[model samples]
Target: MSDTTATPTRPVNWTAISITAAVVMGGILAALLAVAPRDDGGIAWFDPMIPGGWMAWTLPVAIFFWCIASLLVTFTILAIRFPETPRVGVLRIETTRGDRLFISLLGSAFICLVWLFFAGLPVWGALALCLVYAAAVFRWV
Candidate 1:
């Protein structure tokens, strides 16, 4: 004799994945389109990425914030679809996905700041270092 009750299978959540992809792609597109004014330097008419009051925000700054927003959206989706248990990493502390993400972001910021201090702008090198630091944080903390 078989049991009357049975568990249902979990199908892949393509909709969640699609929405996450759209957020990331749209962010990238916005980053690419973030341009300062061709002629006028004033904030009243130019800057697509930044608002009127924020004259200090440039393409790099806009892209950085956009990337952070995209990451938050992706992580939210992941947490909802696949819940995870906190795991101990090299830091000797238990960390959930969100915790790990926070650590990574914090470390990457310091890394970029240090790189900027030592070197100079055109921050490609700093970005590369940040990427590696972020990967290592995710892998081993």
Candidate 2:
């Protein structure tokens, strides 16, 4: 009988991963608070978070970057823990988890652009469609 399990090149340093996750989460929380509008006008430390109208940094843009960072971190952890081998999917080409992630992200971007052209802003509906599209890509593509 032949063994199938692939051995990891190096042991995963769980402490480092945990610390990284904590830092990522902390940054996200800090960003959220920074963009939050307060009735006190953000004067004192206890007043509230930072001013939202600081340069080009908007709440939505911050959240988007945070989400992207979180996804990358999650995928990195999964790769370290599971170590996937590229497999052929519906596309009849070998693809790893990272490849699927890339495809989904690219497709989602296109879907948003097309949806914007036809449906206009408040992209909640487009977001739902993108979620479905991403699920489909991860499942079969």
Give all candidates' CA lDDT scores: 0.76, 0.80
lDDT of 2 at 103: 94
Give a tens-digit lDDT track for model 1, residues 1-141: 989998999888879786768876796755466454444544333244445664666655565677787788788878987899999989999998899899989988888788889887868998888888888888885
TM-score of model number 1: 0.71
Model 1: runs farther than 4 Å from truth? Answer: 1-13, 20-36, 39-55
Which ten contiguous residues of candidate 2 have the minimum total lDDT? 43-52
**What pairs collide in candidate 2?**
none
Best by TM-score: 2
Q: How many residue pairs of model 2 clash at the backbone? A: 0
TM-score of 2: 0.72
- Tens digits of lDDT, candidate 2, 24-96: 7888768686656555575233332345545555556666777888888888988987899999999999998
